[model samples]
Target: MTFSLVGHCAETGQLGIAICSSSIAVGARCPWLQPGVGAVSTQNITLPALGPQVLEHMACGLSPTQALDSALTRNGYSQFRQLAAIDYRGRTAHFSGSETLGCHHTLPGELCVGAGNLLAGASVIEALVRTFETSGGQLADRLLAGMQAAVAAGGEAGPVHSAALVVVGELTWPIIDLRVDWADEDPVGKLAQLWAAYRPQMQDYIVRALDPTQAPSYGVPGDE
Candidate 1:
């Protein structure tokens, strides 16, 4: 009951993932990324470890396809899992197990990969890749736009309760990691709103982490 996209921004060398699902807290278990490495999404049967496992392989100089293949080979339950990856080089790869839910498919695009299970149709995946390619601005915005287009095209077979957007640059942690872990309605829209509010402060937060003295004031009580 999940739809996801893994993308790489060639201009900025950023990696990101956007995902939504009928299931709760899809973010907590699906997206995985390492700065300068890659982005990975592991869903369907959902072996959360596969995200990091695949990334480890990518960090070791394997391509997205080779990394995913190496990781899946170690799991006896691969037949039920769905996974996708995009390396720093923008090469993409994906696997859809034979048992994926309802109408499921994986579509690879330039510097991106879209995958879904229990979706309305293959058009969902198509819209995801197409929108990402055509969208503009930051990597995070493109990812969110791709997700919004996928939903408009026909999202999951049922309502989506949770959504997430994650992006990583040249840091050890994600620059954008916003999630609507559980919402009664329009979780993707809620996630987009969160990103809107966070975008202006994203750089400030990084500055705070890297150099407190150079960081701006919090604009709260004591800081003011």
Candidate 2:
């Protein structure tokens, strides 16, 4: 019931994940990323702990594939889990277990991995990877584009109600983290609108957190 992609931007050394699902609050469970470490998406039956475990393994110097393998081996029901990881160096790996629900596919690319279960078909994942590879702009933008492309190519077997986009740069906190917990309409598009509004002020928000005295004003009415 979920489709997700984990990606790295070689130019900026940023890592990110974009995901959508028919399930409620998919973002809070599926996507994980640590600055300078890696990005992981654990879906299918959705083992939330495995996402962080994979990140920790990568932080301990394991490659994406090695980390995924280690995580899978430790799980008793590995057959129900779908996993994907992309390391700091942009090496990518993915696994869709044999028992994943409905149709599923994982497309591992040079700097990204796209995976999905209970999807429209292989074309969903295909469009995700292809769009991510060809689209330009920030890493977050490309990730969103990939998500949009998946929907265009026929997204989840059912309508997707929740979506998320997360990107981390060189900070302790994510550079971009947006989610639509549940929406009757297009959650991905709602996320895109949030990104558009957030893009110009993202740096300002960080600056405020790091040094408020030097931060810009509210840019609102009557503040002076």
Candidate 3:
């Protein structure tokens, strides 16, 4: 059983996703991002290979929906797939196949959207969709809030296991990519807290990458 939300922030101007599941190590099955390209999440009877292939199609100028359609068409077992994609420009596309596990649904929104599978109930998806659209903030903040709403609405029926969040910019290698492969409990909360903690570090890293050799002037005695 699992409930996941994979989406990109339009104004954050980055591609990213937040995911969780009752399944052991769900991170291993979903979430993929490449800077300057696109983002993909292949799950729910997943055809994992499609994730990368979708990016290739998008790179060739195909829109999000067109890329998804072509990728699914090429898959031998398209009916069993639950996948979503978002391009660099914020266009979104998703497919929830007929053979999806149970109570599976995906909502496509303007700035963001989400897909859920093996859900505890229909409420999970509903809450996520509402949160994504109603939440006010930049893209990343909205995505995070939507995910927390889904978890609060009762996440996957199975025990909390693994969780992950990935974000990338036009040139940023990885602004945020944190994973809790297997947590005893509250993987989503842990992921949120982890993200909060890592944000500053990542920002610092970005700063360093952009212009290193500048040190913070804290407690420095008068230099000669």
Task: Residues 1-224, candidate 2: write the lDDT tens digits.
Answer: 89998999999999999999999999899999999999999999988999999999999999989999999898769899999899889999899888999999999876999999999899999999999999999999999999999999999899889999999999999989999999997999999999999999999999999999988999899856
Candidate 3 lDDT, 13-86, residue by residue in tens: 67877788776667677887777678888888766688888999999999989998998898778888888788
Candidate RMSDs in Å, in order, are 0.8, 1.2, 3.2
Per-model TM-score on C-alpha atoms: 0.98, 0.97, 0.88
- Pitting candidate 2 against candidate 3, the one with the higher lDDT is 2
Model 3 bad stretches (over 4 Å) = 215-224
Poorest 10 consecutive residues of model 3 by lDDT? 215-224
Q: Give, for candidate 2, the lowest lDDT window spanning 10 residues.
A: 215-224
Clashes by residue pair, model 2? none
Model 2 regions lying over 4 Å from their true place: 219-224
Best by TM-score: 1
Count clashing residue pairs in model 3: 0
Give candidate 1's error at residue 15 in angstroms: 0.1
Global lDDT of each model? Answer: 0.95, 0.93, 0.77
Worst 10 residues of 1 by lDDT: 215-224
> For candidate 3, what is the TM-score?
0.88
- In model 1, which regions exceed 4 Å deviation? none
TM-score of 2: 0.97
Q: For candidate 2, give the lDDT of residue 108.
A: 88
